[model samples]
Every structure is written in structure tokens, then in C-alpha cells.
Target: MTHAPSPASSDRFKSFSEFYPYYIHEHSNQICRRIHIVGSALVLVILATAIITRNAWWLLAMPVVGYGFAWVGHFVFEKNRPATFKYPLWSLMGDWRMFFETVSGKRRF
Candidate 1:
């Protein structure tokens, strides 16, 4: 089996684009992507509900609904550092892109 490449350096990322390959490298596991997909969808739903009902609670649920599943996937399946720890914004974008790639047959896993 091909092994996932270890991070070359822990040095700070200069930009989000620079961090994306490392982010994708960390998400080498199929289970991780699946969890991200579910979590992101839940986040969207929660945001939509918050918009509709104007409930502050739905906004508060973003982390629970988003990171909960994602963390589980990271800790249990991938056993790797999530890009969110460093590149929060890009990691969010990466999560959605990776989810779509997996769903649309662009990514094998």
C-alpha cells in the first residue's frame, strides 16, 4: 500500500493555496472525506435554518454540527492533523471541494 507522505515542515503556511496540498495529503482516508461531506451538509442546513427561523441556537450549533463529525473522522480514521488547526478558512473550502470531488468522481476515494 502507498503510504501517506509525512509533513515536510511544521513551519507556518504563507497562504491558503500553499496549504491545500498538505490539507489534501492529510485527508488521505476515505472515511475522513465521507465525514466531511456529512458535516458540511449539516452546516449548510443549520445555517439555512438559522436564516429562516432567526434562531441564535442554530448558529451556535455550527461547531457541533460541523467539527464534531470532522473531528471524529480525523481522530478515528485518518489519525492526522486537520488543516483546520492552521488554515481554518482554506480548510473549510478544502472540505467542500474534497467533498464534491469525491461525490463527482474526480477523487477516487
Candidate 2:
């Protein structure tokens, strides 16, 4: 298993491939990962609802619903600061990737 990067590490990842192991490491906690998966699933549901109903309001709640659940898991369960604060785009990508990986049985749920 790849060791998680230290919280104090100052290394800046140049690629998503390089960052993903660290992303997975950060979510080592089962409950935290489960929460994130739920959040991502809700995000997909909200997106489909918005598109199907032509209601843009649901779109506004995506980030709130997604980030809210994720933050709770990070602060309460993982007891670690989110990687999002430092790597917004990569973190978002990581969330979705992790979600799919978990759901597809590539990673433990």
C-alpha cells in the first residue's frame, strides 16, 4: 500500500496520477470514504434531477451537498484537513474517481 503523504509535506503534485495514491491514503478511514461515496452519489442524483426537470436550482445545491458531507467525514471521522483546500480541481476529480472505484468494487466500500 502506498503510504499517505505527511500533512506537512510541501510537495506539489504535477499530475493526477501522482496525487491519487495520496488521495486514497487520505481517505483510509472506512466511514470517511463511505460518507464521500454517499456525497458523490447524491451529487449525481442531483445532477440528473436538474437535467431531467430543467430546474437549475438543484444545480446550486451540488457543491453544498457534496462538500458538506465530505467535510464532515474529514473533520469528524478522518480527523484530517481536506486536500481540497490545497488542490481544488484535483480533489474534485479524486472524489469522483474514488466514488466510482468504490462502487465498481475496485476499492473497498
Candidate 3:
């Protein structure tokens, strides 16, 4: 038996600029996109707290908190796999950009 590459893995983006549109499309569902924003914001807060308190453990919880909400959104609302599995860097950039876009009022939450 042979395994097929996931669509995300099949297309290798040369730059984050190239992947962002696709990233936006993947998060088309309103609830799913909103969850991502909340998750990203929580991650930032945890990082800030970690820095202020000098507690490194909060840093460890970042990925869990961030990806936990995002994965739920993808699995339950979007019914799709997360791009992070195949495109970590681009996916991270997409998450932050999407968060900022939402905050900036460029993209509706």
C-alpha cells in the first residue's frame, strides 16, 4: 500500500507570502477563525506572563494552548486537518498574521 501526501504537504510554498492566501481560505469558517484568534492571544499573554514572572513552564504550555483550540476548530468546525502538521513555519506566520488581521479590522472575526 502506498500513502498519498496531504494536499498541504504536496504544495511546497517558497515563501510565507505565497501560503497566506491558502491559509486564509482554510480558516473560512467564522467560529474556527475566531477560535484561532483567541488561541493566539492566549499564547501571547502566556508568553508575557512567563517573561514577567520568570517562569519558563508557562512557555511550555504555549503550544498546547494554542494548538488545542486551533485543532478543535479545525476538527469540529472546519472538518479539516491543520496546516501546521505540514507547514510549521508558514502556519505559525499565518496564525499571527490572521490574528493581527482580525485585530486590525481588516478581516472580520
Q: Per-residue lDDT of 8-75 in model 1, one digit per residue for the tens?
A: 47666666666677778888788887888889888989999999999878898998878999999999
Each prediction's whole-model lDDT (CA)? 0.81, 0.92, 0.89
Q: Candidate 2 lDDT, tens digit per residue, 1-109?
A: 6567644455688788888888889998999999999999999999999999999999999999999999999999999999999999999999999988889999999
The candidate scoring highest on lDDT is: 2
Task: Return the TM-score for each candidate structure.
Answer: 0.78, 0.91, 0.88
lDDT of 2 at 84: 99
Which regions in candidate 1 have their CA more than 4 angstroms from the true location? 1-10, 103-105
lDDT of 2: 0.92
Model 3 ranges off by over 4 Å: 1-10
lDDT of 3 at 64: 98
**Candidate 3 lDDT:** 0.89
lDDT of 3 by residue, 15-108 (tens): 7777787788889889999999999999999999999999999999999999999999999999988999989888988999999989999999
Output the better candidate (1/2) by lDDT.
2
The number of clashing residue pairs in each candidate reads 0, 0, 0
Q: With candidate 1 superimposed using the best TM-score fit, by how many Å does residue 102's alpha carbon deviate from the native? A: 4.0
In model 3, pairs of residues that clash are: none
